[model samples]
Target: MPSTLFGFTITDHKKVFAIALPMILSNIAAPMLGLVDTAIIGHLPDAIYLSAVAIGAMVVSFIYLLAVFLRMATTGYIAQSFGADNLAEQRQHFNHGLTLAIGLGIAIAIASPWIIDFSLWVVQPDAALIPYASTYIGIRLWSAPAALTILIALGVLLGRQQSGRAMWLAIITNAVNVMMDLVLIIGLDLNVAGAAWASLIADYVTALVGIYWCAKALNWTPALLKIIPDKLSQYLNVNGNIFIRSLVLQLCMATMTGYAARYGSDIVAVNAVLMQFLMLISLGLDGIAYSVEALAGAAKGQQQPERIRYWCKLTLVWSCIFAVFYSLIFWLFGAQIIGLITDLPEIINKAENYLPWIILLPLVGHWSYWFDGVYIGLSLSKGMRNTMILAAGFGFLPLWWAGMPLQNHGLWLALSGFLLMRGLFQALWLRLRWRQVV
Candidate 1:
């Protein structure tokens, strides 16, 4: 028998890791697609190629991020239903999630031309780079429906504690993406457009694999998908809150990219590399966060407040440990990492100049990621939405404006402050509402 403390057993740690480790692997692989894309484009004759890919990718990412509620809402809902041993409700949630994902994806695809135009206008890339970025977006936008479907499927797997399946989904998708990237960009000599086509093919492949797994696991039938207005209304309500929260976060990111672009292509390229580091850290921590989401949601379903508390404590401890590890890794190997991303000596040197901010990011940013998982698990979207809104509106924007005089340095400072504020404010919210949310 395992030792227990405050209702958390040693077994709980094992359970959490079982769920988290695979997710960590999955999350890490998620970024390899971007890394490979960067590496492919970075070797081009002009830094403009790298900047174009970065801007175009960021635009697509912003659109997807806005609708990420498809995944988060589905995971939270299904985890609760699974914990309560309500098979019928799980099926219902799964169907609802899938329906919404497909519908929203189609809508996004239809709206892509306008979204691309708006994003380009906001980011304000160099005039020469606009065509390259536009080409990338035009091709990748076709993948929206498949990509969104994958999100819902991944959420269903995670909520059901089927982490292995989720890991495979990520691995297969990203692996295909990398291989296709090499073939399309390097082998075919297609450049940025090749990268976009690779992503589109990989996304659809992943969606097919995910849908197959989901149908087989859930024993899903066509008949089960008849949408109930009440259930859908409830689903939309939760997702609406998360959508607003996600939009705020994406806007902040887009704003940062736009600011970086204004400084010139060199700055944009360097920031893109630095942002990859941030993504690596976020994804690694999110492994732990995803576990917490599933476990905490399940605990809530069982009405096990003590278990939720224990999870919160254990998750924080692990998050801090990982944060320290990441900071040290960046400090020690920052140069080597930058070198691998791009051959451009200028971009590499510029990235090295900003390496310290990357080092500090994990430490300042981990708490917000942890709190996001907790809130999502508890279905506390309204609070999550409110926290992000305040952080973005009150904290990030003002800091960004104030730092404008400093150029790239100012932009980075503002971004770092934004991450710190998000963590701090969300921590305060969690502390005050622990009793209620848990």
Candidate 2:
């Protein structure tokens, strides 16, 4: 059945929503951790603590996201392996991805201090906020290896259509995080340290759950760990391409945060709130992309090019419809939404100015979000890497730099421009690369 523009097609509607629901619920919960932290800190004894957590969380995000290739690369390979019905090949991809994530996580943990020091240098956080940020990043950094390991293993499960388990894991983790946040932040008054600790502990618990589920789901054995030499090389090449792609994408985010930092803590708090809002939409939309990636990769592995087009069209239609709906909701409930997540009067006021930007993000951003899934599913990492790099470097940075002289609104405009630029470049890249097909 075809998906309708404004109504459900019995079969396709159920399929798409079934794929998206767990992801959407999990995505909503994921941002609540940050939002909960921010809301709690906003009501704390001072605003500095809130700002500190915001910066420290960004540092944490930057570090772990650097190895996001583990998840993205693993998903495609696993999907392809599934499509081919090659159980041995699937097990090899899963094991290799897990191995890479753990090794990368440990390496990051060892070098965390230097990474934090560099980030602090660039951000030059307030002295009062510095200690809080340090306490948070320092402790949270150790959780990297476990977090990545879980992420990669979950990606493998997701490739095999086990998103329900992944959804449950996230739900359990978020529920734990919320309970811990209240106990640590409000009950014990640990402030930023407490929030950080809650997150770290939650990740560790979730990772354990993921490890157990992974063993049960996969054909794990001594031999699968042996790793096929040529296939391993192909996995590395694909992962490397996606690593570069995600790095450029992360840089754009880190750079934007850097720019926000230049405006002071007040603006930083405002940026923090706005970022949380943006994350909610981005992560929610990512569900569709993820489903598409799995579907498309399976199609490619089976040499069914027509299925790729069908899945792409279905994903885009549903994603765009959601984007439109999200835009309207944001436009009408902008202030109320901000009000729910924060307590500080000034930051809430400042957030009003940024609400417009958040509202328009879905319309300007949904294509790139959906396109990323299509490419990942197709294992077109080279194309993904090239497009993101070109977009971030040539498109986003240049326009952002050009608007630097305007100060306040300039930064906001630059960010919006960057989003627009990414959407445009990715759209163009897709058209060019798949000219005959698209």
Alpha-carbon lDDT, every model = 0.86, 0.79
Scored against the true structure, residue 233 in model 1 reaches a CA lDDT of 96
- Position 230, candidate 1: lDDT: 99
For candidate 1, the C-alpha RMSD (Å) to the true structure equals 3.4
lDDT of 2 by residue, 143-192 (tens): 88778987887788777767778788877777777788889999999998
lDDT of 1 by residue, 1-438 (tens): 779754557787788889899998777777766576678779877787788888888788878877788889988988888788887888898889888888888888888889889989977888999999999999888899999999899888998889999999888877888889899888998888988998899999999999888888788886888788998999999999999999888879878987787899889888888888987787678888898899888888888998778777887788888999999999999899989888899888888989888888888889888888888888888888889988887778988999999888888888888878888788888778878776
**Candidate 1 lDDT for residue 94:** 81
What TM-score fits each model? 0.86, 0.85
Model 2 spans > 4 angstroms off: 1-9, 33-55, 126-135, 178-198, 261-269, 339-356, 435-438
